[model samples]
Target: MATLRIGIIMHGVTGRMGMNQHLIRSIVEIRKQGGVTLANGDRLLPDPILVGRNAERIAALARQYGIERWSVDLDKALANPDDTVFFDAATTQARPALLKRAVQAGKHIYCEKPVATNLAEALDLYRAARAAGVKHGVVQDKLWLPGLRKLQLLNDAGFFGQVLSVRGEFGYWVFEGDLQPTQRPSWNYRSEDGGGIILDMLCHWRYVLDNVFGKVRSVSCLGATHIPQRWDEQGKPYRATADDAAYATFELENGVIVQLNSSWCVRVRRDDLVTFQVDGTHGSAVAGLTDCWTQSRVNTPKPVWNPDVRQTHDFFDDWVKVPDTTVYDNAFKVQWELFLRHVAGEGEFRWNLLEGAKGVQLVELGLQSWKERRWLDVPELTGREGA
Candidate 1:
């Protein structure tokens, strides 16, 4: 009967991902749709105040998005009693302190992945939010991806009997800013600036593995800075102190082995920039960002691997495409609506700060496994003693 307006403080949305995905695609689209419809037939509208260190950039973004509220001072923004939610998509090193400040300000928290640089900090952030008695969530956008959703459906339907392993190839060449401008921020290749493929992507693998297929039990990873020299945004040359490539092997609890290669130096040769091939006893499927192809045991083609003779196998023809029977929305926007509903007492939100901390734990173990040159077991995480 009445509109439920939720005030949200949106910080660090002046950057690429913050500006594109979170601001324009998710929040703006939500506002365009006239807000999220609640279970009781009421709509929950988000009133966002954009905040950033760059006043000019922030103001430009606000005006472009038709948002009236904008601020450069985070403290002043947090002081607004009307705003109950704080969302951050900023640099990894700055996320903890910002989220902590928001928690202290009695604002609910939602943030991007790798919650902190390390496991302890991530857990502490979760603890701070818990102590403040504020609702919290993390961005686990891949769960709703259309291709992965199809994989989930097939897995749920027992389409792949006795799953064996998953192999993921994710990457495309990012320019070094010499001849071609770099697509990623220069900070992404600097370790001191919270840069590295392992730190950046392992958290994603942690959740995707646990939620989609099975819980990861152990990890073996090797990191490399394939491109040592890179140019920054200003075209200044600098030594890349971070690993641009990560070769990780994860053993899931169900005995499924997952090998994922994440790199910024490799060329794209697959169906998509990122693809996951799931092989099982009865069937197999390969999924990209938007499409998934499956090949049943009955339909699989027989190929002879003979170096002596050139055989025309037509290797890619055996698999059939998966249809989208259900309509899908933007992954980030879908999660946003779910979190907003959870904050408004719709239901339990499972992907909280604690879940996010688990991702950080995986990152820690992944780096340790690489450093020690051995597989490290992932110990089960629990809440702080006696809560």
Candidate 2:
């Protein structure tokens, strides 16, 4: 069998999402499974070099994952001709400069969402990558999620005839790090450090809305910093200047209305940490991170409002659980395999740098909407591949 070893520079992987999702669950898992197979009987094997600020921590991570390479010098890694692909999962604020350098070095680029703090930088990065003629991509892992996959299947099957509206509820109570240790990093709460719920989650929402439902036309958003004070990793008190919660509404090109509520200040009472409910003319479905439940028009139950008495009906019993007909792999891993194939010229990759810029545009517009207290039109980004 023909084996193609592809060198990849993995940067900012010391962070939680970078370490767990990109490295361990995706890349390492691919290695464990003998790499991605091609149709022409060749296998594309990834050779990843971990790049981070802390040598000791990165070295430990590399050793733990059975990786042979680890480096703290990004310039050294970029100088190597063998490492053709540069993957960044670094802080959002640092992404633009890192990507610019990688693109200048003529390396294929892949990275996490919110490509930049604003739309201009994001578009600039995209343009630079396009000018360099390097393969580029952004992470839209939610589309590969099992629950969302099921929703896609249902849409494909025409289960939701003339899909009407979508409601997304995401996030949960993140401890203030005063008494209980915070689950998320301290940087996520600092605006100067590129921290905020809108910047972080809106990117995910934009992709999900565009790919699954329809292209977003306009947006209305309201943001809040519910918990003003919190403790950092060092157990010291700090003012949380960044917004922790967002209530947003989107109007799609297809006339579908979408309302999304994202917050870290609220407690979870839903089926999962994040849940989406879609209602159509013929049916409705609720999807969590890994599960989906559907209720058809025929199965819809009629209920009478009685505010004076306790309701006896179990409202949750009407929807039927969607079954998993096929085994699902890790969402990030699935995307990674696709990217590998795309790089090898075996598949098409639509989620490119321009798509990432669209996500950044949504975040920028959302922030503008919040500030102006009015609906903002999501203008189409110019200078894309087709445009």
Model 1 C-alpha RMSD vs. true structure (Å) is: 1.2
- Per-residue lDDT for 1-387 in model 1, tens only? 788899999998988888898999999999999999999999999999999988898899899999999999999999999999999999999999999999999999999987999888888898889988999999999999999999999999999999999999999999999998999999999999999999999989989999999999999999999999999999999999999999999999999999999999999989999999999999999999999999999998877679998776787988999999989999999999999999898988899999998898998998998899999999898857234
Best by lDDT: 2
Show the colliding residue pairs in model 1. Answer: none
Off by over 4 Å in 2: 384-387
Q: Taking the candidates one at a time, how many backbone clashes does each contain?
A: 0, 0
lDDT of 1 at 75: 98
Candidate 2 C-alpha error for residue 375, in Å:
0.5
TM-score of 1: 0.98
- For model 1, the run of ten residues with the poorest summed lDDT: 378-387
Indicate the worst ten consecutive residues by lDDT in candidate 2: 378-387
